[model samples]
Target: MKNYILITLTNALGLYIASLLFPAITLSSIAAVLWAGLLLATISLFLKPLLLLISLPINFITFGLFTLLINAWLIQLSAYLAKGVSIPNFKYALIPAIIIFALNRARLSLIHDKS
Candidate 1:
C-alpha cells in the first residue's frame, strides 16, 4: 500500500512537471489530475516497460525510436483509463512519457550510486 502511494506520487509529480513543459496536455486541476494521472500511470509503470521489452525486436526493427511511440501509447492508455483526466493530444502524452522514462532511469542510477 505504501509503495503504491509512493509510486503514484512520483508519477503525479512527473505529470505535473510535464504539463508545465507542454501546452497540449492540461490537467483539470493540479490535485485532481495529479492523483488521477498518478493512479493510472502507476499501472503503466508496472505494465508498459515489460510490454516494451517484449516487443524489443520490433522496436529495434523500426529503429530504436519506435519505443517512444510505444511509450506514448501507454500514456494515452493511462489517460483513457483514468476518468476526469485528459491527455489533450498524443504530442502531450509523448512529453510526459519521455520525461518520466528518462527521470526513472536517472533515478535508478542515483539509487545504485549509493549502494
Candidate 2:
C-alpha cells in the first residue's frame, strides 16, 4: 500500500514535470494529473511485467533498450484512458517516459538506501 502510494505520487510529479518540459504534453488540471498518475501507476504495476515477459526476445536483442518503448506505450495508454491528459503521439511520449522511469528508479533507490 505504501509503495503504491509512493509510486503514484512519483508518477504525478513526473507527469507534472513532463508537462512543464514538453508543450506537446498537456495536463489540464491537478485532478487530471492525479488521475493520470494513478492510472499510470496501476497500469505499470499490472501490465508492465507481462509486457516485459512477452517482449523478452526483442528486449534482449535491443540490449533492454526496448523497455523505453514499453514505457512510452504505457504512457500513451494511460493518456488514452485518463481524461484531460493529452500526449500528442508516441514521439512526444518518449521523453516523458524517460523522465518517469528516472523518477521511479530514483525513488526506489532512495527507499532501498533507507533500509
Candidate 3:
C-alpha cells in the first residue's frame, strides 16, 4: 500500500540520517540501509506491538522508559536481520534508536491517512 511504502521510505531516511549522526551505527551500503529500513519497519509494525502488549505491566512500572529499551532492542534486531548494518553495543544503539523513533513519530504526525 501507499502508506507502507511511505513509511518504509521514511524509515530509510531515518536510518541514513542516524548513520550520519552516529559513528557507532554504520551502514555499509545503500542496499544495507534500505534492507535495515525495511526490516525495521516490519519489526516495528508487527513485533513491537506484540512485545509492548506483553510488557505493558513493566512498561507501566518503569513509567514508559522501558519502551526506550524496547526501541534499542528493535534497532539491534534490525541490525542483525540486515547485513552490513552494525550496532556494536546497546550503548551504540540507544541514540540511533531514539533518533529513528523521533523521525518515525514526526513523519507519522505530519502525514494524514486518506483512508
Candidate 4:
C-alpha cells in the first residue's frame, strides 16, 4: 500500500515535470496534476497489463519496443480521463512516456545496485 502511494506520487512528479518541459502538455492547476497523476497510475496499473498480454506476440517481435507504444497509449488514455490534463496530440504523449519510462529504469537500476 505504501509502495503504491509512492509510485503514484512519483508518477505525479514526472507528469508535473513533463508539463513544465513540454508546451504541448498542460495541467490546469496543481490539483489537476495530482488528479492526472492518479489517473495515469491507475490506468498504468490496470489497463497496461491487459494490453501487454494481448500484444505479447508483437511485443516479442518488436524486441519490446511495443512496450513504449503501450506506455504512450496509457498516457493518452489518462489524459482523456483527467479533465485538467491536456495532451495536444498523440506524438506529444510519446515523449513524456519515454521520459517517464527512462526515469523508472534508472530508478530500478539504482535500487537494484543498492540491494
Candidate 5:
C-alpha cells in the first residue's frame, strides 16, 4: 500500500513536470494531476507486464528499446482514460514516459540502496 501510494505520487510529479516542460501536454488542475497519476499507476501496474510479454520478441530484437514505445503507449492510454490531461499524440507522450521511467528507476535504486 505504501509503495503503491509512492508510485502514484511519483507518477503525478512526473506528469506535472512533463506538463511544465512540454506545451503539448496539459493538466488542467491539481485534481486532474492526481487522477491522472492514480490512473497511470493503476494502468501501468496491470497492463505493462502484459504488454512487455506480448512485445517480448520486439523487445529482444531492439535490445529492450521497444519498452519505451510500450511506456509511451501506456502514457497515451492514461491520458486518454484520465480526464483533464491531454497528450496530443503518441510522439508527445514519449518524453513524459522517459521522464517517468527515470523517476521510477531512481526511486527503486534509492529504495534498494537503503535496504
Candidate 6:
C-alpha cells in the first residue's frame, strides 16, 4: 500500500509537470489536477495489470504494441474523470501515458533492485 501510494504520488508529479508544459492539458487549478492524478493512479493500480492479462493474446501478436492503445485509453479515462483536466487529442494523451509507463517501469525496477 505504501509502495502504491508512493508510485501514485510520483505519477501525480509527472502529470503536474505535463500540465505545466502543455496548455491543452491544463486543469482548472493545481488542486484539481492533484486530485485527478491521484484518482488516475489509484484506478490504474488495478486496471493496467488486469487489462494486460485479458489482452494477452493481442499483446503477444502485436509484440506488445497494443499496450500503447491501452495506455491511451487509460489516459483518456483519466481526462474524462478529471473535473478540470483536458487533453487536446490522442497525441496529447499518448505522450503522457508513455511518460507514466516509463515512470512505472523505473519505479518497479528500482524497488525490485533494492530488495
The TM-score obtained by model 6 is: 0.82
Cα-based lDDT at residue 27, candidate 5: 88
RMSD of each: 2.7, 0.9, 2.1, 1.4, 0.9, 2.0
Candidate 4 stretches with Cα past 4 Å from truth are: none
Model 2 over residues 47-110: C-alpha lDDT tens digits? 9999999999999999999999998999899989999999999999898889988998999899
Candidate 3 local lDDT, 12-32, one digit each (tens)? 787788789888788899989
Candidate 6 wrongly placed segments (more than 4 Å): none
In candidate 4, what are the lDDT values of residues 56-86, reduced to their tens digit?
9999999999999998888888888888899
| lDDT (CA) per prediction | 0.74, 0.93, 0.84, 0.84, 0.93, 0.80
> How high is each candidate's TM-score?
0.74, 0.96, 0.87, 0.90, 0.96, 0.82
Better of 4 and 6 by TM-score: 4
- Against the hidden true structure, what lDDT does model 3 obtain? 0.84
- Residues 27-114, candidate 5: write the lDDT tens digits: 8999999998999899999999999999999999999999999989988998999999999998899988899999999999999999
The ten-residue window of minimal lDDT in model 3 covers 106-115
Q: Write the per-residue lDDT of candidate 6 for residues 1-47, one digit (tens) a residue.
A: 89767776776776777777777777787777777778778778779
lDDT of 6 at 56: 98
Per-residue lDDT value at 43 in model 5: 95
Cα lDDT for residue 8, candidate 6? 68
User: Whole-model lDDT for model 6 versus the true structure?
Assistant: 0.80
